[model samples]
Target chain A: MEITPAHYTVLSAALFSIGVIGVLVRRNVIIIFMAIELMLNAVNINLVAHARYLENLAGQVFVVFVIAVAAAEAAVGLGILLAFFRNKETVNIDEMNIMRW
Target chain B: MAEAIAFYTLAVLILGLGVAVITTPKTVHSVVFLVLNFLCVAVLYVVLRAEFLAVIQVLVYAGGIVVLYLFVVMLVNLKRAPEAHEDPRRLARLGLALSGAVLLELAGIVVYSYGRVTPASAPAAAGPLTGAGNTEELGWLLYTDYLIPFEVASVLLLVAMVGAIVLARRES
Candidate 1:
């Protein structure tokens, strides 16, 4: 069978759901960050697939920007993780309730 | 036939690695799984003919971002399991149910949209992007039409760099 955009879309959705489950269930802050990255990658896959199907370069361009932003996010997020780890010596998100009401 | 096979194989690998990244007990192992997942995505990009983005995925994601993750993983020092403590009022089951709802909503949107306009029926948006190569065409677009966003992304990266430094620095 010829591969259509739906195949890619379904695959992207499955990957994204896994990322969501990761973010929700995982307690490690670092792993949660990785899950967030997984979600970003899923979006990128969808964009690229649609771009290819539509013969548009815009989707690919958006993917580039997404990667840049993801990098920036990872850097800042990991930096915050380090700062928090230094203070509390743990990477657990449950303990991240300093400001919780 | 070949294309379908490739897509299926890559999709399985990508989803499997994604699951591994999230479910692994060790943070370091999770990072390793994440790198593999990224590599698989990069390969999928190649299959989709976005060679430039594939290279960027491998370089920026597998190369730069994964290294950053590894460094952070090392620095955080996971001497003790991070999941030892459970908040008494935490709604873990609720969170899972909510996420499942999100998945169902996304799937619904996909089915609804596909039903209205099939991908096979839609007119091709425009002529194929013309240029010397994938990288060249992408680069031209990046410099010309997308120059503003490109420049803004650079500035964002700069700010993030400075902020990361400040955030991670020791208070002596």
Candidate 2:
């Protein structure tokens, strides 16, 4: 069987669904962050696949930007996680209700 | 035939590692699984003919972000697992239902789009870059059409670095 763009799309969608499930089901903040990264990777896969199928460079370019943004997000997010853990002493999201009304 | 085999193998590895990263009991183990997932994704990028992206994915994600996660996991030092405290309000069930709905919706969109649109032939304008190689074409576009966004990305990285340091620093 030949690998088509549709195959890539289907794979991307499955990966994305797993990421969504991870974000929703996981309690650990760090694990949730990893799930988010997985979602981003899925998007990158779709972008590059389409770029190849369409013979355009734009998709690859966008993937570059996505990677940069993801790097920044991970840094800031992990920093926040560190600060939160320091204060709360737990990584559970349910316990992070300091501002709850 | 070999390409299909490699693609399927990488896809399964990527998805399986992703699931492990989310569901693993220990955060440290989850971080390790995440590294493997990222590496598989980098390989997928290479298979898709984006060599530059594959390298960047490995360097920045597998190299940089996973380390940050590992450091935080070690520093946090959890006495009890995060999963011990279930909300007990059926929220997990609700989350599952919500995510299932989202997945169905996304699948519908993908199928609809694929059915409606036919793949177009490659445009004639990109002919010059076909011979330029992946990295060179990417670099040309990055420096030319995307110069402003490129500069902005650097600034964003700098700001993220400063912010992370400030947030992680000990209080005086």
Residue B33, candidate 2: how far off, in angstroms? 1.2
All candidates: TM-score: 0.96, 0.94
Candidate 2 — which residues are off by over 4 angstroms?
B119-129
- How many backbone clashes can be found in candidate 1? 0
For every model shown, the clashing-pair count is 0, 0
List where candidate 1 sits over 4 angstroms from the true fold.
B122-131
Best model per lDDT: 1
| Candidate 1 chain B: 10-residue stretch with minimal lDDT | B122-131
Look at candidate 2 and tell me the lDDT of residue B63: 93
Q: Tell me what TM-score chain B of candidate 2 gets against the true chain B.
A: 0.90
Q: How close to the true structure is residue B150 of candidate 1, measured as C-alpha lDDT? A: 100
Residue B153's C-alpha lDDT in candidate 1?
A: 99
